[model samples]
Target chain A: MKKELEKRTVTGPDGQTFEVEPLIDYYCEAHPTVQPPAYSKIIENLFNWARSESIWILGFGTGCGAIEMRPLMTPRFDAYRYGIQWRPTPRQANLLIISGYLSVKTLKRVIRSYEQMQSPKYVIGLGSCTINGGMYWDSYNTIKRLDDYLPVDLYIVGCMPRPEALLEGFNTLKRMIRAGNAEGANTYAANFDWYKTNQKRVIHDWDMPDYNW
Target chain B: MQQFEWIQIPYSLLTLFIVLNFGLLLNALMAKIAARVGRRRGIPIYQNYIDLIKNYGLRTSITHGIMFYLGPVFRLAGGVGLLLFVPTLYGSEMFSNLSFAGDLILALYFVFFGALGMALGAGESGHPHAAIGVSRGLSQMTMAELPFALAVFSVALQYDTLTISEIVKAQQGSLFHWTLFTNPLAVAAAMLSFLGSMMRPPFDVVLAPQEIPIGPPTEYHSSYLALMQTNRMIFPIAKIVIIMNLFFGGATNWPIFFAKVFLIYLFAVFVGVVFPRFRVEQSIRWFLIWAVPLGVLAIVLV
Candidate 1:
């Protein structure tokens, strides 16, 4: 059983073989639920309501879907109407939107950003590209099934969804939050090892620290 | 009357709670009005409360150091203290709070307590943006305070007392007797400074939300952000109350106080929306070039 899980070794371009820690053994443990307990129903409800209203999204745009997000900030859709704001740093944001196709290089950064964000956070996968790699279905670098790597709370389907669709998606997300159904971060933590294995199989550079935290 | 001693704690707490909530309400109102100007639907009036509660509810946060932990505490303390230091109603002991702590000079200096502590705390945050923000904020604050200090000096010289209550009493009894009418130049200079100190646009480069990603509070989150949010509400109201007392004639009742405070806050919001932000150096130059001469003129007139 002990031998079944071994440290990984990757050869760099410089011909250096470096031993790398697999994310499963080196990262994430299931933590106590962040929400106030059921006994404190009032506090829990208040928290959920607050969380539903104010959603700060990380400003990490991945692909063609990023163009659609700009219109949401314009006079047209105006997502701020729903208390949706974009935060520059991952540390302070609660939502991550994976737009369009994810190339292997971009996926590395996405994983790092997702791990850096505080818990009780979420991941919103956008377009057919994220769902099934869309036009990149046969490409070598673009990921086909995003859920196999990161836990996606919502999958917005389209080649490139319009702003109206994005707004509807936000509304759907708000509803899920109000009902206490969005638990992607917690789900990721609970199944860390399985997710890590899937993530490590692609992109073989494997040079980062064990846990971003 | 002896029982009053026992109730001071609760009374002061009640006043603080009212001010905090009212501050949030006023902020929401201001944001909504600004949104209207831009032809967009804005947030609900009670959104600040929701935001505060949500921040407190965040499950995880990382602290940079002990100073970072105390930064929000210092800011909140300064805001609450500033509010309590002033006598709210003309003749009500119930709302007077701890006004006996000190007088005008103390209140003037107390405003810096928060800024200084916040800068120190942000320094410890280790973010280069926080440091940049602190530098800009402190330098701008130095210039901004000069006009206000001069206006206060003029009022103190005109009234012959540095006690804020006495200054308020001096402005009473007639509509035309208020300093806004009586010392229009001083009020003009001080109000100009007020716009800068409140972090309205043209002077809001420090929190240019999208530009530098919230500047000084870049690393703050959860309850720490909550504390800063509470200060965001109270500190401006507290400063406006001081200016209102010194220049607008202190309110004789609660209704008048609310109207006066709203009107004062509205001026800042109006200015914020119509103009774009001035870079830190430009804003400082703005205060010196325009506001300083007006301040000197007001002082000379007195």
Candidate 2:
């Protein structure tokens, strides 16, 4: 565990001392609950449509495939017109694009980020690597199947999928969302222990909270 | 002065609704214009609305503390308060809103209110990036506001009144009587300061979207983010309305109001597209050296 995250005593400016457990004090330990769809079907549909139209992507480049995402913002692709914006913070983003191979090391951070994101979030397993480890199939550090760890909505399979393929994948995800098919966040909450065990099996040193939120 | 009436509440709300929609559309239009400059297609005009809905629709929302909850609330309040206090149309009773005696001072206070509230709220979030962003934002805002404050004071000095309606009334009757012609230096100073406040290029380091993980709103999400997004639409238009009333002649009705507001907003976009971003210290120095002098001269000449 990090020193900052460890239980310790500290003195304040007024010379008062108090015990502080970093992990307990800093993070919310309550587990995430499965949030049901809106009460009315019509309202749910409206929300789902809005979600599909405004895809705020968390711009965390996990692997080599992240290079492909840059083109989506360029003139040729121009994903902005489609309402796909790249948000720097995980908090503001609803779409997590796991762009390529996820090493055990990177997966730890990815899980943290993924957990921090608000519910109704969708994850995309980008490239062949995230689908089945691609060229790093024999490597010990690489995560073979992305679905074993996170609830992946769609997979754009390629060594590194072209920007066009990624766009197609986004379109498909939008369709899924509009159809009320993409409930990955709920799925993850329902199978929390199963996913946590899978994550812990590969992560080894899982010092952080079970749920980052 | 007109007596306070029970009808003004709904009247003001009507004005708020109009400005809110106008602000959202204007934001998209400016973005489209910026994208066009880069040879790329921009977002749809309705993208802001969709984004707002999507954010509000998110099921889960985490908070650092009570302050985090108030941050966006305060920001929205600041935007709303600024708009309501200032008269929208010059002479129309329906659209005049809640403008009262000495509204210019209140408008100025409201301008800084949101940032202060956000700073406290972001501080409670305990993100280092938020802290850095807040510090940078407040400093930049202070420097940017200097020329604007001076220009406002100069205009108040020029017209010899603090009431916005009176100021607008003075600028009425002819094009040459507008402050842009009557007090060009103050207009120039305020226009330059306007770029800084607009959060576009050259002064956008406060948000620094590429770096520091999006500044003060790093820890904000879901409904909290939705509130801030609402303010983002309203605040800019409110500021533009103040500028329109002060420099250009105040609008008489919805169409004229729309045209003046769009043109003023375009001026900021025009400057934003042409210039590259400046570092915080460099921008502060730029404002002090160039903009502040013009404002001082405006006051001196008046």
Candidate 3:
């Protein structure tokens, strides 16, 4: 149990050395990994066909852009026509929409949520805030680019992208998913350390481990 | 009654295959119809097929010990076993499957197998949401089952035979002879309970995806979810079939069976699309207030 805590002493600019206590007091285990069994080509094709048709989004609603998302469910925009759905839990969601601006506080939760999701997940950096922080570019807490912290498969640009634009983006995502071209999850895992470093730079007093899975 | 034939295995399997596909189609169609109610283009009728495939194709999985893994097995077994035990067509030998295995009482008891398995599996998964869901589900189930139980008891008493085939034979003479006509009060109570059992709105707080993120299946993913999804499709059909057999007169052929089952399934769908969900206590109160009295009256009348 002693190995669980690693002590670090750091000196502030004033040159006073202080013990750095680990901020994380509680622990919940990281999800265990089981190698997904291999499927034959015929089965793979069937899966691809299915994955293309249905996209269950992790409805995190990180920012104001989430306003646009409501219309997708409403009668006017109706994203269900393309088989798009919103899932409350990350485990059931195959897509994550970083809707609009992400504050450092929310990003930490976003990272945790993303990690909890099963593999083959895709991230959509929605609206200009997720692209380059949009109107809040100069805000202290808002992130400039979502791609730096999360492996985003697509970007839907606009101050707040309209529901129609979001629908168009979804169709493109469907096309990409159908072609078996979305490999963002693999890319994220390969460069996980880099993503963590970037994330930790923005988010301090982090309680969670370096990676969720 | 003890004729154990290997041929029945394949026949039961064949019925399972058909019901799986039919259930998928029925759910997708309901989703489409619900969308139309709001004047929107809904998902395609075949979307459930895609969903089942996509779920099975997920590339990663996390197991929460042994019971979580066995949960879906018990669920599917419950659905298939219940179907196999019920005679599909009164006169057809090939489609009989294993109806000789049990009577109506056995079939009624068999309905709990899946729910018990799910509760155990969800409990072991260690998600508080799952536990909350199971509790709500079991509680709601207790209230829902009471009305159905009374109706079943009344029907059994009315027929004076516990065998399902015998009950169906009793209702065979004319459309007017069906329980919907013969025992209108019991059928009304049973259908209301059917809506509750279907997990439609006002009774769907157990899943409450918005509040609990799909409750019991919150921790489930990939092929584990796929197994549950397969059961989701089959279990409802199995439940509806029993209701149809006991109340609507067992179908004489495949087409009649499809029509009857779809109509019964649609009753839940129609209610789901328009109504908001009930809190657990609210649902319990609602069932006790409205359904329980009808069931009691039906029993008193019988």
Candidate 4:
């Protein structure tokens, strides 16, 4: 555990001392719950339609696949026309594109970011590396399967998929959202312990809280 | 002036509804224009509406504190307050909104009020990016507002009244009576300051998208983000309303109002496309050196 995260006593400005546990005090410790769809089917459908049309992607690049995403914003691809926009923060983004191979080290940070995203969020495993580690399969530090650590709603398979393939993958994800098929957030909440165990198995130095959110 | 009537409540709400919708569409339209300049198709005109719905429909929202909750509220209030206080149409009571005696000063206060509220709210989020953004935003806003404040004072001196409606009334009857012709120096200064407030390139260091990851709203998401997005639509248009009334002759009806607002908004968009972004210090210096002197001269000549 980090020294700052450990339980310690500190003196305040008024000279009174109090115990502070950074993890518990600073972050919400309550586990995330599965949020059901809206009460009326019509409303849920409207929400699904809206979600499909406006996808705010978290701009975090886990691996080499991130390079491919740049072209989508360029004049040739222009994914903005398709309602796919990049958001700088995880809090604002609904789509998390794990672009390529995830090492155990990067997976820890990815888990933290994934947990921080609001419910009804999605994970897209991009490139062959996220599926079965691609060329990094024999490496000691790489994660073989992304689904083992997080709920992946879709996969765009390639060593590094072209921008065109990524655009197709986004369209497919949009269809899944509109059809009410993408429920990866709820799946992760339901199988929280199993995913955590698998995550812990590979990440030896799991110094952070069980859930960063 | 006529006595305050209860019927004006709905009348003002009607104005708000129209402005809100217009602002949303105008924003999307401006984005499309910018995209076209880059030779791309850009987002649909209805994209802002879809984005708004998706943000509001987001299932979860977390807050840092009461201030975090109030940040967007204050921002929206600021935008609404500015719009309602300013007269939208010249001589027409139905669209005049809640304009009254000394509304120019009140409008100025409302303009700054939202930023202050946002500063406090973003400060409470405990994000370093938000803090940096708030500080940069406040400093830039203060400097940018100087030229505008000077221009407002010069306009007040030139017209010999502080009421916005009176200012509009004085500018009526002929095109040459418009402040743009009567007080060109003040108009020039105010127009320059207008670029800073519009949050476009050359003056958008406060948001600093690529550098600061969206500044004050860094920690905001879901419904909270939705509220800020709503303000984002209204605030710019609200500011433009003030400019239209003050510089150009105030509009007489809905169609003219829309046209004037669109043209004024396009001025910023045109400049935004032509220029690259400035660093915070550069923008502040630009305002002080170029804009502030014109305002001072406007006041001095008046």
Candidate 5:
């Protein structure tokens, strides 16, 4: 744990020490907490029940992040060493790895795929692309924050993160899974204005036509 | 008795040998070229033949249904039918038995069987990306058909025959006899149209890796994948051969025909390097507006 802490300690924009897990904890705390779904504990327990064994992955290689998935699967890093194997179709996969930004066109496809998967499935956002659109924040397409639309269990932060970083993220997700907190509930009831402003900036500007439909 | 006496046995066998050898030779040759461009040390000249023979021995799985199984068989048959009809050289009857009496339009539609098979197989895969790619491939083909039809129509009118062999026979003289000189704009339009038809660069959006890994080849594996790969290796050579027979006289020897086709192929690669792929809508619009008009003009002029 001390070694993990040392790796995460870094200077932030304000020149203050920022520890990664603490920052994540703070962010999670800042958001409003909603009650877990009906039979929530059962879902949570079931999520934990399947975590340790046979971690089947539906790794959607959408963008540059797809290249990162190669090392994880191949001999060098060998994610299968941890019992993680890539499933061809989403229906058989336990975890959905959204490897990068969700283009509007691709997003529809992703949603359909997500729906097709069996229940007790978890989503791991691969990089900054899934978290906040990463470097493509200014692009006309791409969803800004994955959390706005789909439930993301883990946000593996990287601007094209390294293989080691991916392993670290996987470890973190494993820890979370063990805690019987697998089902990620959307805590915030409504932040319509805040989300709308971000959506406007990312998808369309004020100059674009306001279809209003 | 007289008819039996008139029949030339060795001549028929010679034609069979020529065609069987031609198909084997060209498929072997293009596999090397594609491997080289893809930056691999490479397969042996007969590697495709070995692969094809090996495919028959593999354990097969047919989950997606009948369309998937039927796709490659149809494509192979169509390719063979095309090879028979398109005249490769003067005074040859290589594909004479299968080559129905048809024109350039008939020849164009002949190869579309392969594309249709690929599209149907892709749709049956149950992968959204493959389905999307098939739709895009179909649309791109529709766009390309216009200018290509027009360009070939001009050639047909110039020579007054739809038979490719007749066209080549008519162009037996010097460079000036080629239809390429007769209408440079039509040639340019046809070549642009060919990019989409061939699914080469600037029109390779249907198979973009970043968006969709390989388009139709996405779900294919093992023997199914091998069949599709063979179709790709043969399809380009067949198309290039048609171009040669139409414009340049089909060479009686290898070097001249290969040289002309290579130059056109290089021109295609150069064009790909210069332009970026247009979106599906953009491709459709450009083909309809620019290509169709040029085609219609060529047809009118012819």
Candidate 6:
């Protein structure tokens, strides 16, 4: 099993081949020094909103994070009762729930989808993996800090955030919606520095292939 | 709601002749226009007859589902039913004075049912792309129906009778002079809704071939597919005839009626070629936000 796992190598967009495990460990250690209580509260308030309670998710299960969304939607957790159904089309989707790290290949597609969603849409970063590169820290292909590119509303901690933890993240979102605070969406649009910086970094990497196509 | 005697053989024969084939001639003409509008080698005037006979003679593949079997039959039946309901000619009655007070509603419902049956059959045929197409088709129809219904009800209100004959009688003037001119709003709404409902373009998201391989009927093949194609070709003519009879006089000579229906068909073809299909949700949003409000405005004005 170890040998088979060893054979599987995830190449980064920059053509880097750092071992996946150590890359993840080194990245998780580099955490944000500040965790704003106001930010957390804003997330909680969004969940409390009446319309936010039954928030339907755009049913996109891309990676490991996608697997976790299943239980959250099933009977045990039963997200549907809260009006959280999966929408098929981007135009109908109000919330884009990105489950895990996005590959360079998928990142552009995600951007297209994000753009397609009408204004007042929120992006929920589902796992620590999505927060700051998590396990894919040195994987040149995997985007570190998905928020660095796309504005993420709430990032649930956990290499793979548990289903229960996902619920907490959802509640946080509902609270934010209730406060009539569309700050997350606004914040994403306002802060282009992170996206621009990462865009430069990824583009500058000599090994990374041209992404204009 | 009065029951008319059904014992009259002439009534049945005339009903068969008019209802079964009222739109056949008009459809053949429309096909000629469609071919030209599409910039394809146009079929001869008698092409529809050849195709009809070929489809009739061929054995259709019965996909196991009940819907697959029922779709084409319903379209044919609905076409006949709609033709019978519309007031085609005056004084020269056929198949025993078979006019009803609320036949227009029935005619409208028949058109919807036929379109729905085809969509449903296409949806259930185990093709993901087709299913998506059907869903889009249904969504578009849902949007289109609002304006169409509002317009129909407005016309019903004007004549104080649901029958086509009563509606036509109320507009007994020159050929160009009709209820459509009197209630322009309803007429406009009806035309817009009909364009979308018929899945004509911009609204043709249901079967966008480039996007999803003929959409719902993507899996259909051989003769079974032919029935659907035949129905698709023939059914639009029925819809066009109904539109013509309502907007222009149905019996006001072949030339005038054909011209009006052709005009409607021409606009639909232009729309089809000009605009791209709307995303399912976007189309719905458009219908609810714009079409519904416009329909209400038309109703109020009417």
Candidate 5 residue lDDT tens string, A145-169: 8877556788888877888888887
Candidate DockQ scores, in order: 0.43, 0.91, 0.55, 0.83, 0.02, 0.01
TM-score of each: 0.90, 0.98, 0.92, 0.99, 0.54, 0.52
Q: Which stretches of candidate 5 lie over 4 Å from their true place?
A: A1-213, B1-60, B93-100
Residue pairs that clash (backbone atoms under 3 angstroms), model 3: B202-B278
lDDT for model 1 comes to 0.84
Task: Report the lDDT tens digits of candidate 3 across residue range A145-168.
Answer: 899999999999998788889999
Tens digits of lDDT, candidate 1, A22-127: 5454544333233433457787777777888999889989988999999887677778888887888787788999999999999889998887777678889999
Give the Å shift of residue B154 in candidate 3: 1.1
Off by over 4 Å in 6: A1-213, B1-40, B53-62, B95-97, B175-177, B252-255
* Clashing residue pairs, backbone N/CA/C < 3 A, model 2: none
Which of 4 and 6 is ahead in TM-score?
Answer: 4
Candidates sorted by lDDT, best first: 2, 4, 3, 1, 5, 6
Best by lDDT: 2
* TM-score quality measure for candidate 2: 0.98
Writing each residue's lDDT as its tens digit, candidate 6 over B1-302 gives 33666553466556455433535555555545554554543434554444444333222123537776665666556655555555555333452245577778888888777767777676556568867877777777877888878888887787677877667667767745686777777777778887786666677777775567557666554345446655665566667766765665555444554566667787787777667778778778877777777778877876
Error of 4 at B175 (Å): 1.7
For model 4 the local lDDT of residue B51 reads 95
Ranking by DockQ: 2, 4, 3, 1, 5, 6
Residue pairs with backbone overlap in model 1: none
DockQ-derived CAPRI band for the predicted complex in model 3? medium
Candidate 4 docking classification: high
Estimate, for each residue in A44-141, the C-alpha lDDT of model 4 and write its tens digit.
Answer: 99999999999999999999999999988889999999999999998899999999999889998899899889878999999999888899989999
Which stretches of candidate 2 lie above 4 Å from their native place? none
TM-score of 6: 0.52
DockQ of candidate model 2: 0.91
Worst 10 residues of 2 chain B by lDDT: B56-65
